[model samples]
Target: MADNEFQSFLTELRRGSLTLAVLGCLQESYYGYGLLQAMREKLIDIEANTLYPLLRRLESQGLLLSQWDTSESRPRKYYEISEKGRLVYKELLAEWRKMQSSIDSICGEGEEDERFN
Candidate 1:
Protein backbone atom coordinates (compact mmCIF):
# COMPACT_ATOMS: atom_id res chain seq x y z
CA MET A 1 0.00 0.00 0.00
CA ALA A 2 1.15 3.54 -0.69
CA ASP A 3 1.73 5.80 2.34
CA ASN A 4 -1.49 7.75 1.85
CA GLU A 5 -3.57 4.61 1.33
CA PHE A 6 -2.11 2.95 4.41
CA GLN A 7 -2.84 6.08 6.43
CA SER A 8 -6.40 6.07 5.21
CA PHE A 9 -6.81 2.44 6.23
CA LEU A 10 -5.42 3.18 9.67
CA THR A 11 -7.80 6.13 10.04
CA GLU A 12 -10.78 3.96 9.19
CA LEU A 13 -9.62 1.30 11.66
CA ARG A 14 -9.26 3.85 14.45
CA ARG A 15 -12.60 5.46 13.71
CA GLY A 16 -14.49 2.27 14.61
CA SER A 17 -12.91 2.08 18.03
CA LEU A 18 -13.37 5.75 18.92
CA THR A 19 -17.03 5.30 19.81
CA LEU A 20 -16.30 2.31 22.02
CA ALA A 21 -13.40 4.03 23.73
CA VAL A 22 -15.34 7.21 24.34
CA LEU A 23 -18.37 5.34 25.62
CA GLY A 24 -16.29 3.15 27.91
CA CYS A 25 -14.47 6.11 29.38
CA LEU A 26 -17.68 7.95 30.10
CA GLN A 27 -18.63 5.27 32.67
CA GLU A 28 -17.14 7.85 34.96
CA SER A 29 -18.18 11.42 34.49
CA TYR A 30 -15.58 13.71 32.95
CA TYR A 31 -15.33 17.09 31.35
CA GLY A 32 -14.06 17.32 27.77
CA TYR A 33 -10.43 18.12 28.60
CA GLY A 34 -10.41 15.67 31.47
CA LEU A 35 -11.79 12.92 29.26
CA LEU A 36 -9.16 13.69 26.62
CA GLN A 37 -6.44 13.43 29.28
CA ALA A 38 -7.91 10.17 30.61
CA MET A 39 -7.93 8.59 27.16
CA ARG A 40 -4.32 9.72 26.68
CA GLU A 41 -3.41 8.11 29.99
CA LYS A 42 -4.89 4.90 28.65
CA LEU A 43 -2.68 5.35 25.54
CA ILE A 44 -5.69 5.96 23.28
CA ASP A 45 -4.58 9.43 21.97
CA ILE A 46 -7.74 11.16 20.71
CA GLU A 47 -7.73 14.79 19.59
CA ALA A 48 -9.90 17.53 21.07
CA ASN A 49 -11.40 18.27 17.65
CA THR A 50 -12.39 14.65 17.18
CA LEU A 51 -13.58 14.00 20.72
CA TYR A 52 -15.77 17.08 21.22
CA PRO A 53 -17.88 16.32 18.19
CA LEU A 54 -18.23 12.68 19.19
CA LEU A 55 -19.36 13.69 22.66
CA ARG A 56 -22.03 15.86 21.17
CA ARG A 57 -23.22 13.14 18.84
CA LEU A 58 -23.43 10.58 21.61
CA GLU A 59 -25.40 12.98 23.75
CA SER A 60 -27.73 13.68 20.88
CA GLN A 61 -28.21 9.98 20.39
CA GLY A 62 -29.30 9.72 24.04
CA LEU A 63 -26.35 7.59 24.93
CA LEU A 64 -24.88 10.14 27.27
CA LEU A 65 -25.96 12.76 29.74
CA SER A 66 -24.20 16.05 30.24
CA GLN A 67 -24.32 18.84 32.76
CA TRP A 68 -22.54 22.11 33.09
CA ASP A 69 -20.38 22.45 36.18
CA THR A 70 -20.22 26.16 36.89
CA SER A 71 -18.81 25.87 40.39
CA GLU A 72 -15.26 25.64 39.11
CA SER A 73 -12.93 28.33 37.81
CA ARG A 74 -14.32 27.80 34.36
CA PRO A 75 -17.65 26.25 33.59
CA ARG A 76 -17.17 22.84 32.08
CA LYS A 77 -19.54 20.35 30.53
CA TYR A 78 -19.34 16.98 32.27
CA TYR A 79 -20.46 13.85 30.52
CA GLU A 80 -21.49 10.45 31.82
CA ILE A 81 -22.77 7.27 30.28
CA SER A 82 -26.52 6.97 30.41
CA GLU A 83 -28.38 3.71 30.99
CA LYS A 84 -28.80 3.37 27.24
CA GLY A 85 -25.10 3.95 26.75
CA ARG A 86 -24.23 1.25 29.25
CA LEU A 87 -26.44 -1.21 27.41
CA VAL A 88 -24.91 -0.23 24.09
CA TYR A 89 -21.43 -0.51 25.51
CA LYS A 90 -22.15 -3.97 26.81
CA GLU A 91 -23.41 -5.08 23.40
CA LEU A 92 -20.45 -3.53 21.58
CA LEU A 93 -17.96 -5.08 23.96
CA ALA A 94 -19.47 -8.51 23.34
CA GLU A 95 -19.34 -7.99 19.59
CA TRP A 96 -15.74 -6.84 19.78
CA ARG A 97 -14.74 -9.89 21.79
CA LYS A 98 -16.49 -12.17 19.36
CA MET A 99 -14.67 -10.56 16.44
CA GLN A 100 -11.35 -10.90 18.21
CA SER A 101 -11.99 -14.54 18.81
CA SER A 102 -12.89 -15.12 15.18
CA ILE A 103 -9.72 -13.34 14.03
CA ASP A 104 -7.67 -15.45 16.41
CA SER A 105 -9.26 -18.61 15.06
CA ILE A 106 -8.49 -17.56 11.48
CA CYS A 107 -4.89 -16.90 12.43
CA GLY A 108 -4.77 -20.22 14.27
CA GLU A 109 -3.60 -18.47 17.38
CA GLY A 110 -2.86 -20.76 20.37
CA GLU A 111 -3.29 -23.73 18.12
CA GLU A 112 0.31 -24.84 18.14
CA ASP A 113 -0.63 -28.50 18.56
CA GLU A 114 -3.20 -28.31 15.79
CA ARG A 115 -0.63 -26.88 13.39
CA PHE A 116 1.10 -30.25 13.27
CA ASN A 117 -2.13 -32.18 12.72
Candidate 2:
Protein backbone atom coordinates (compact mmCIF):
# COMPACT_ATOMS: atom_id res chain seq x y z
CA MET A 1 0.00 0.00 0.00
CA ALA A 2 1.06 3.58 -0.51
CA ASP A 3 1.91 5.83 2.48
CA ASN A 4 -1.47 7.51 2.43
CA GLU A 5 -3.33 4.23 2.39
CA PHE A 6 -1.17 2.86 5.22
CA GLN A 7 -1.85 5.95 7.29
CA SER A 8 -5.56 5.64 6.68
CA PHE A 9 -5.48 2.01 7.67
CA LEU A 10 -3.70 2.85 10.92
CA THR A 11 -6.15 5.62 11.75
CA GLU A 12 -9.12 3.32 11.22
CA LEU A 13 -7.51 0.59 13.31
CA ARG A 14 -6.84 2.94 16.20
CA ARG A 15 -10.31 4.48 16.01
CA GLY A 16 -11.92 1.20 17.05
CA SER A 17 -9.64 0.86 20.09
CA LEU A 18 -9.77 4.46 21.27
CA THR A 19 -13.09 4.15 23.10
CA LEU A 20 -11.96 1.11 25.03
CA ALA A 21 -8.65 2.73 25.92
CA VAL A 22 -10.39 5.86 27.16
CA LEU A 23 -12.87 3.79 29.15
CA GLY A 24 -10.05 1.82 30.74
CA CYS A 25 -8.18 5.02 31.55
CA LEU A 26 -11.19 6.37 33.42
CA GLN A 27 -11.29 3.41 35.77
CA GLU A 28 -9.66 5.90 38.14
CA SER A 29 -10.70 9.53 38.25
CA TYR A 30 -8.72 11.90 36.04
CA TYR A 31 -9.11 15.30 34.51
CA GLY A 32 -8.77 15.80 30.76
CA TYR A 33 -5.11 16.74 30.50
CA GLY A 34 -4.17 14.22 33.12
CA LEU A 35 -5.84 11.47 31.19
CA LEU A 36 -4.10 12.55 28.04
CA GLN A 37 -0.77 12.46 29.79
CA ALA A 38 -1.50 9.03 31.20
CA MET A 39 -2.35 7.68 27.80
CA ARG A 40 0.82 9.18 26.35
CA GLU A 41 2.85 7.57 29.10
CA LYS A 42 1.32 4.25 28.22
CA LEU A 43 2.30 4.80 24.55
CA ILE A 44 -1.33 5.25 23.56
CA ASP A 45 -1.47 8.44 21.59
CA ILE A 46 -4.88 10.12 21.97
CA GLU A 47 -5.27 13.64 20.69
CA ALA A 48 -6.99 16.16 22.98
CA ASN A 49 -9.33 17.18 20.19
CA THR A 50 -10.60 13.64 19.86
CA LEU A 51 -10.62 12.90 23.59
CA TYR A 52 -12.69 15.84 24.87
CA PRO A 53 -15.67 15.15 22.64
CA LEU A 54 -15.44 11.46 23.39
CA LEU A 55 -15.56 12.16 27.12
CA ARG A 56 -18.68 14.25 26.74
CA ARG A 57 -20.36 11.61 24.60
CA LEU A 58 -19.52 8.80 27.03
CA GLU A 59 -20.81 10.83 29.97
CA SER A 60 -24.00 11.58 28.10
CA GLN A 61 -24.37 7.89 27.33
CA GLY A 62 -24.28 7.05 31.10
CA LEU A 63 -20.99 5.22 30.84
CA LEU A 64 -18.98 7.78 32.73
CA LEU A 65 -19.41 9.92 35.83
CA SER A 66 -17.88 13.37 36.13
CA GLN A 67 -17.72 16.20 38.64
CA TRP A 68 -16.06 19.54 39.01
CA ASP A 69 -13.27 19.51 41.53
CA THR A 70 -12.66 22.95 43.01
CA SER A 71 -10.40 22.08 45.88
CA GLU A 72 -7.44 23.74 44.20
CA SER A 73 -7.20 27.23 42.73
CA ARG A 74 -8.52 25.99 39.41
CA PRO A 75 -11.63 23.92 39.06
CA ARG A 76 -11.12 20.82 36.99
CA LYS A 77 -13.62 18.33 35.69
CA TYR A 78 -12.66 14.83 36.79
CA TYR A 79 -14.09 11.67 35.26
CA GLU A 80 -14.38 8.06 36.26
CA ILE A 81 -15.89 4.96 34.78
CA SER A 82 -19.44 4.37 35.96
CA GLU A 83 -20.62 0.95 37.06
CA LYS A 84 -22.26 0.58 33.68
CA GLY A 85 -18.99 1.49 32.02
CA ARG A 86 -17.20 -1.22 33.97
CA LEU A 87 -19.71 -3.83 32.88
CA VAL A 88 -19.48 -2.71 29.29
CA TYR A 89 -15.71 -2.68 29.45
CA LYS A 90 -15.74 -6.27 30.62
CA GLU A 91 -17.92 -7.31 27.73
CA LEU A 92 -15.82 -5.36 25.24
CA LEU A 93 -12.65 -6.93 26.56
CA ALA A 94 -14.05 -10.41 26.08
CA GLU A 95 -15.14 -9.58 22.58
CA TRP A 96 -11.78 -8.02 21.82
CA ARG A 97 -9.99 -11.18 22.92
CA LYS A 98 -12.16 -13.29 20.67
CA MET A 99 -11.60 -10.96 17.77
CA GLN A 100 -7.87 -10.90 18.39
CA SER A 101 -7.75 -14.68 18.46
CA SER A 102 -9.51 -14.79 15.13
CA ILE A 103 -7.11 -12.25 13.67
CA ASP A 104 -4.12 -14.17 14.93
CA SER A 105 -5.46 -17.35 13.42
CA ILE A 106 -5.71 -15.67 10.05
CA CYS A 107 -2.52 -13.61 10.32
CA GLY A 108 -0.43 -16.34 11.92
CA GLU A 109 0.56 -14.06 14.84
CA GLY A 110 3.25 -11.89 13.19
CA GLU A 111 3.42 -11.49 9.43
CA GLU A 112 0.19 -9.58 8.90
CA ASP A 113 1.09 -8.79 5.27
CA GLU A 114 -0.32 -12.12 4.12
CA ARG A 115 -3.30 -11.98 6.49
CA PHE A 116 -5.95 -11.63 3.80
CA ASN A 117 -4.82 -14.80 2.14
Per-residue accuracy of model 1 over 1-117 as CA lDDT, tens digit each? 799999888889888689999999999999999999999999996889999999999999999999999999999999999999999999998998898789889987867668888
- The residue pairs found clashing in candidate 2 are none
Whole-model lDDT, model 2:
0.91
- TM-scores, in order shown? 0.87, 0.88
- Runs of candidate 2 exceeding 4 Å displacement: 1-4, 112-117
**Which window of 10 residues has the lowest lDDT sum in candidate 2?**
107-116
In model 1, state the lDDT of residue 20. Answer: 95
Q: Which ten residues in a row have the lowest lDDT in candidate 1?
A: 107-116
What local lDDT does model 2 show for residue 58? 93
